[model samples]
Target chain A: MKVLVAVKRVIDYNVKIRVKADQSDVDLTNVKMAMNPFCEIAIEEAVRLKEKGIATEVVAVSIGPKAAQEQLRTALALGADCAIHIETDERAESLAVAKLLAKVVEEEQPGLVILGKQAIDTDNNQTGQMLAALTNLPQGTFASEVVVDGDKVNVTREIDGGLQTIALTLPAIVTADLRLNEPRYAKLPDIMKAKKKPLDVKTPADYGVEIASKVSLLKVESPAERKGGIKVASVDELIDKLKNEAKVL
Target chain B: MSILALADLHEGQLAGATARVVAAAQAIGGDIDVLVVGEGVHAAAEAAAKLDGVSKVRVADNAVYAHQLAEPMGALLVELADGYTHVLASASTTGKNVLPRLAALKDVSQLSDVIAVESADTFKRPIYAGNAIATVKSDEALKVITVRTTGFDAVSDGNSAPIEVVDTVVENNQSSFVKEELAKSDRPELGGAKMVISGGRGMGNGDNFKLLDGIADKLGAAIGASRAAVDAGFVPNDMQVGQTGKIVAPDLYIAVGISGAIQHLAGMKDSKVIVAINKDEEAPIFQVADYGLVGDLFEILPELESKL
Candidate 1:
């Protein structure tokens, strides 16, 4: 079985994102960019499958600006065979991204597709499931654990109440959750090797997919800051405030 | 314009989040219709009919929808996509799993986890873990949306809408229901609870969670954990409250030893009142907290338990 892992480049998780002064969008002028945390987990899962001899190959794919190739290279360093970059300047929404990936799925002919549950930049947990819908494949989302049997994949999903397990046929889509597996950092040698790996760059138009955003962004602004109130000096005072002042107790 | 709100039905009862979604749909200003899709979901349909602003309830009772599985549910929504100007659902795991599929099937974008309905075509949602709010307008004629129910107040029961059985259940043989291991708790659910008490890495171990049990039981508060605590294997993942975890809003939220990472604050900052108890006085949690107490959790928690 072959696995295709979709990765994305987003603002590093540790960075505090700032909205531009004009409120057009987040300030990305000199911000640090890294592979999306969940996508790294997905790549790690696929590579682990390959290491275990359950998968024959793992291909990394990304859809973003030209700079997104950095994320693809990172994926390659993490043990993906090669990289595919769908170059686009437009911030394509989940619908368009899924369509492009669906076309790529047809070209790749992989038995399993793995993607992050959501991207940190847009916070849209849609693309993987959307790809599954477009290709009429079963999706196991928010997967914390995945095991491949003879022709079926057993996935443990992290849901609201607890975990839910589902089994899908070989050709399925699985979205990685945080607890899936901690991604391994690429060694210096692997990073150097990834620099020389084969990378194919294509435009969305190459797949006959239009890169039009369906949602129009009107504005972006910082969330309202909560003003801190004076703290009580003692537990008695805290209880008094809770009982009399806030009346929440 | 007409809004079709998908009822979040688990088993046979209408989820409380469905009422909140209906309220969000009402805010969008439209004739609202509730779609209840499940097996033996007449009770859910009846409950949806009683929602304050619903005009009609459509029930598509089928075995394929028994577990809110995505495959058949997404196909059914796509088949019924016509004739509705807007399709809304609660931003639950089920809705998150299905709405995007429907949007893709229609070749349109989905506005997800919407915190406010700005206009018929515009919505305000949290991006980058609620640090920033983005106002977005969808050009798609048929808008597919999912609202974070915590952002909207649930509607009260006051209407008697007509229940119409919908026979437009699309069938798919892609996946089937598997076993679920839900946490059986006697306390109120975290999302619906009036009060919440959450711990973080400072709790040390799973055994230390007992320090909160006495207080939680006394106050009828739901127990939660910061992502660090969950990552430390001190609690189940479901108890996690953060950006990638469960978003919760209650009347009162107490943070015990929770330093409050940006992601964790995004989930609980919407609570009416927040109290942070951390030994680090400079912890960022205190910045947004209405009340802050600086002390060792082991001493403070025991003291709090004794006093309360």
Candidate 2:
């Protein structure tokens, strides 16, 4: 069985987000970029399956500008057999990215597809489910654990209150949660080997999908900053203030 | 505009977040109807019908929806999506699982974790873990949205809207429920609690989490943990409070030994009053806290519990 994994390039998680001067969008000028953390977990899960011999091949696909190839190369170095880049300049919304991945899924016909639950940039946890909808596949989202058994896959999902385990037939979609697996770093030798791996670049139009966004960003701004309060000399003072001044206790 | 709000439920009871979703829909100015989908959801449907501003309650009771699996739920929503202008649900796990599929099947875009309803077409949502707020406008005729319940007040329950039975039963063979392990606790849920006391890596281990229990019992507060604690195997993921975890905004939030990373702050910064107790005076948690107490949690927890 072959596994297809979707990765994304986003502003590094450690960088503080800054709104542009005109308030059009976030200021991403010269900020560090990296593969989304959750995507790395997704890639790790796929590679683990390949290592276990359950997956015959692992393919990594990404949708973004040319710079996204950096993330795809990172995915390759992390153990994906090959990579595909859906090169585009538009701000690919969840639905558009899902559509592009659906087209790739149709062509690749991988037995299983894995993706991050949400991209940290948009914080939109929609692409995996949308791709499943478009492709008529069952989705086990927010998966903390995934096991392939016979012709079925058992996905343990991280839900609101607890964990839920579900079984989906072959050729299904699974989205990785934070606890899925700790991603491994690529070695120097593997990074060099990744440079020689085959990378196919394609456009959304090539798959008869348009990467146009339906939602328009009207403005972007920073959240309200919380003011620091005075330090209490003792717990007695904190309790007194909570009960008297704030009246919340 | 006609709006349909999907009711959030737990064990066949309507979840509190459903009321907040209705509050968001009311902001959009519509004839709001609530949809309750689950097996044996008659009581939940009744609860939904009583929420203020609800015009009606639509119930789909079937075993297929017992687990609220995304496949059947999405199909049911698509079948009922013909006349509604907006479909809304709380940004709970169930909503996050199903709404996107409905949006895609309808060939429309979804606005996730909407914090503000600016207009019928415009919304404000937090991106980059609430570090940046983006105001977005959707051009789709049918808008699917997930509401971050903390951003809006839950509507009062008084009105008695009519309840209608939805006969649509979607057949799904792709996935089947295997089992579930839910944490059972008598304490108020973290999302709806009035007071929350969360610990961090400073808690040491799972056994040390017992320290918060005394204070929690005294104040009737819910117990939470920062992602650091959860990652350290000190607690379960459901107890995690952070950007990637449960977003909570209680009347009073107590951070015990928490260093307050930005991701953790995103979940509870909207809290009415925040109190931080940590040994390190320079911990970032003090910056956002309304009251800062510098001390060792091991000693502070017992003293605070006794004083309360």
Q: Among these predicted structures, which one has the highest lDDT? A: 2
Q: How well is each residue in B114-183 modelled by candidate 1, as lDDT tens digits?
A: 9998889999999999989999999898999999999899999989999998898676676766789989
Query: Best candidate per TM-score, number?
Result: 2
- Ten residues in a row with the worst lDDT in model 1 chain B? B169-178
Off by over 4 Å in 1: none
Q: Is the docking of candidate 1 incorrect, acceptable, medium or high quality?
A: high
Task: For candidate 1, state the interface root-mean-square deviation in angstroms to 1 decimal.
Answer: 1.1
lDDT, model 1, position A52: 98
**Backbone clash count for every predicted candidate, in the order shown:** 0, 0
How do the residues A1-249 of candidate 2 rate in per-residue lDDT, one tens digit apiece? 999999999999899899999999999999999999999999999999999999999999999999999999999999999999999999999999999999999999999999999999999999999999999999999999999999999999999889999999889999999999999999999999999999999998899888887899999999999999989988789889999999987
Q: What is the lDDT of residue A141 in candidate 2?
A: 98
Which sections of candidate 2 miss by over 4 Å?
A: none
**TM-score for chain A, prediction 2:** 0.99
Report the C-alpha lDDT of model 2 over B60-82, residue by residue, as the tens digit.
99999989999999999999988
Per-candidate Cα RMSD to the true structure, in Å, reads: 1.1, 0.7
Q: Candidate 1's residue-wise lDDT over A1-249, tens digit each?
A: 889999999999999989999999999999999999999999999999999999999999999999999999999999999999999989888888899999999999999999999999999999999999999999999999998888888889998889989888779999999999999999999999999999999999899999888689999999988888767677778878888988998
Q: Which ten residues in a row have the lowest lDDT in candidate 2 chain A?
A: A205-214
